[model samples]
Target: MTQIAEAVIDENGQIPLMEPLHVIGPHRALVTVLDEPPAGWDETLMAAEKALADDWLRPEEDEAWAHLQ
Candidate 1:
């Protein structure tokens, strides 16, 4: 199955929606849509690098991140 991320709103709060993927054949797969257009390649890469540098690397945070992975 293919997973698509989306934003959804309800009583509790906004939630992310995922679109299901269909398998057409043994070696083929298809997804209907994208949430948004892709961001600038260079800008996106720079932003990611900046974010990584800004966030302090602590032991507890590292452990939590590992759990997510």
Candidate 2:
């Protein structure tokens, strides 16, 4: 079976898979590393961070977690 998995290879060459794989048996795989980020990656990432912050930095969020604190 041929399948592809996504992962991040850390500075020390440690790889962490992005998601769970449901394969039953062990399979050998190859990893490819990119030396640079894709075009407009910074803009895309900033937009995503803003979108998350809009949802995360709300007054209701504080009320929701008031009990925990």
Candidate 3:
């Protein structure tokens, strides 16, 4: 299994993790430095809303979930 943890790299090369990484033993890891700030949840969802609406608006999609209603 693979484990992922978010962290911030400092100017002096220090990394402070945002959360605990549960795992055993030592292992090598990869670090990607993003130049741009990550997008907000609202922006991320709205960006996909149009694409997803293409399928979600279909009558078949509503029928599939009609049982729940």
Candidate 4:
């Protein structure tokens, strides 16, 4: 069986698991480090809002979604 989890690496090169592992005994695992920190809820919302800030106000865009309104 395979399992996945997220962890943060400490300054001393230690990774602390956010949750306890379900499997027991020795097992091989793969680790990948992201280039940038993961975005939280606020960051995601802000990015989406910024991307569509004036989209609805544009004439072409408004017409495209007119049928749904």
Higher-TM-score candidate among 2 and 4? 4
lDDT of 1 by residue, 1-69 (tens): 554444434358544344644557665433344455444646878879867866747676788789678
User: Local error of candidate 4 at 48, Å?
Assistant: 25
Give the Cα error of residue 48 in candidate 1, in Å.
Answer: 2.8
lDDT for each of the candidates? 0.57, 0.82, 0.83, 0.82
Provide the TM-score for each candidate, comma-separated. Answer: 0.26, 0.45, 0.47, 0.52
Candidate 3 lDDT by residue in tens digits, 1-69: 778887767679898888998778998888888776444747988889999999799999999999999
Better of 1 and 2 by lDDT: 2
As for model 1, its CA RMSD to the true structure in angstroms is: 12.4
* Candidate 4 stretches greater than 4 Å from native: 38-69
Error of 3 at 9 (Å): 1.0
- Flag regions of model 3 displaced more than 4 Å: 37-69
Off by over 4 Å in 2: 38-69
Off by over 4 Å in 1: 1-39, 66-69
Error of model 3, residue 47, in angstroms: 28
Q: Residue-wise lDDT of candidate 4 within 30-58, one digit each (tens)?
A: 99998766557468878899678776668
Candidate 1 structure lDDT? 0.57
Range of the 10 consecutive residues with the lowest summed lDDT in candidate 2 = 32-41
Provide the global lDDT of candidate 2 against the true structure: 0.82
